[model samples]
Target: MRASLTPTDAPLRARLLALALAVAVLAAVAVVATVRAADRAAEKDRAQPGEPAAHAGEVTLRQPGRLLFRNLAWGPQRDRVSAVPLTATSGPRTSAPRDCLRFHAAAGTGVCLRATGGVVPGHEAVLLDARLRPVRAFPVPGTPTRARVSPSGRLVAWTVFVSGDSYAGGAFSTRTAVYDTRGGTLHSDLERFAVLKDGRRHRAADHNFWGVTFAADDSRFYATLATGGRTYLVAGDLASRTMRTLRENVECPSLSPDGTRVAFKKRVAGASADAPWRLHVLDLRTGRESALAERRSVDDQALWLDDRTLLYALPGDFGADLWSTPTAGGGAPRMAVRSAASPAVTG
Candidate 1:
């Protein structure tokens, strides 16, 4: 015979029963949520309907009239350096076997920044030849944010965020390196370069530099210098190992092909806290500035598709899609390449 519990003990027993039932219900819901998440993750590995066709093949950065970018499509070829028609980016593409987080190429030379996996994850920068074959690899201390090569393809530069992987909390530190492919000279940290802020010697422990854009001369370059809550467009000399501040609020400066202006991200007033940058161009000779027609906040470095058109990446359905806008600031922004990032024009 089952024994009947006392009044107080019966009430405690009821509470215990209710607690167990609630726990079981919560566990069931959690299991369903986890299963749904796993299914969604699995779906990303399969090619969805209406997606662009991509195949693993030889990708050469030496091919002119091709646009090279980090593929963000969902499939086996995802995250590889892919090549597509410069004008018709919506068409099919050829993906290379090499994977990179950021990539840039010029004059048949490519710099691929990739993540390394082990017990401890890390990153590295790989120099690639015209055939997209790695020539050498350099260990990077942190997450790669930018990679660039000189027009002559003799110099390669990269930037890594040292403190954290992103600018999520408005505080981060970066390390920029420049490698001379021809001379085998490497300046692993640009902070060691002498600073000439305001035409006088400037010394600060808080200084940081990134987003290097080389001049056609290959001896001169421009990059962003940050210190004391302000950012500057600093012109640098590789021969002299010095940098001089030019203007303010310029970040990720990409020099124009003509060497007359720079396309950069400017933090403007009346912008949302999270999305705080607008694409702008600064005339290197005249110091005149003009904002582009891209009203959306662009976080990536702007690349000059030509003298008048600018290309950049924005958040998209797959990962990021490249968009184009007129540099003179008139028409609406147009999507240039879908599911691609880190655009580099091959020549």
Candidate 2:
């Protein structure tokens, strides 16, 4: 026989039980909501475009305009180059056929050509007009490696490799030549430039030249020499007939349109061979240097859109693409062009 409970006590016990059950349900709902919110945040982060990630170097904006690019495709058996245009709003304009190797533009007109077929064993260079039409094709008495036009479109400079064999291991040498478009003659003789070597063995018979560019005034030009662990930037004065070392251990020197500065890529100290190179800007007047944003992989084929912006090729998983950054500094890179390489800009 149990004693009868008071009605007030009984109601109080019932209320406490109900409150505990409600609290447990509320806690469970809160935990689920918190987890869902966290997942949404992570998804948003990955979905955002132009999110800054580890980069190889700083990007600089040299000019504000559309960028026109020339892409080169090389496989185990074949090689070709093409011309394509890109703007901020539209991705890629139109791509020419794969055979086009070199190009130049003026007043909304451009020209390019298929750099095969006409190359001679000792000489290789083919000139084109503004409509992708082949103008004059000739050999430079050596294996032509690089060719570029003056800013005024009146002059052209090129480097050729004089070698005993066809492939990379062969003994090689270089010759520099300049041609006048208006005069219809070669300005400079096929001058012997440099001799390259493999390893400690000076393949006295081998030489290689690359990365050629003209000065702002087109009175002078520059190129690079690679021999084993040593690299050099050679500035040649056409009038003086002399070459000077502008920098050492540097490759791919790109001159600004104004000729006030030069941008290049190089290996940093303690950097692994697999580590990507960084972009650097050099003041021609002061000889001062500054590193751009750093990246994890190599950057290549840097070109100035203007003095303030730099457009370069950044390699991706599928292929290489074009990217732009401000020269003044700060801000992640933006995609200026996709599926592109060897970018050049015209104002």
**All candidates' TM-scores?**
0.88, 0.61
Which regions of candidate 1 are displaced past 4 Å?
1-44
Residues 1-347, model 1: lDDT tens digits: 99887889988989999999999999999999999998877876687676777899988877889999999888778889999988778999899998999999999899999999899989999999999899999999888999899999999999999986554235889999999999999999999999997789999998989899999988999999999988999999999999999998999999999999999999889988788899999887888999999988898889999999999999999999999999988888999988999999986
Candidate 2 residue lDDT tens string, 1-347: 99888988899989999999999999999999999998866653342243212111211112235454554222211112333333442332333333334443332333332334435423345565543445676555554444566666666766555554222232455665676676776754433533222222234223345656677665687766655545666676655655566677666677788888877777677766555367777787998877776354444536777777787776753256667776655556677655555555545
How accurate locally is residue 304 in candidate 1, as Cα lDDT from 0 to 100?
A: 94
Q: How much lDDT does candidate 1 score?
A: 0.91
lDDT of each: 0.91, 0.55
> In model 1, what is the error at residue 111, expressed in angstroms?
0.7
Q: Which ten residues in a row have the lowest lDDT in candidate 2?
A: 52-61
TM-score of candidate 2 on Cα atoms, chains taken together:
0.61
Model 2: residues >4 Å from true position, as ranges? 1-66, 71-86, 101-124, 140-147, 158-177, 185-207, 274-276, 294-299
Number of the top candidate by TM-score? 1
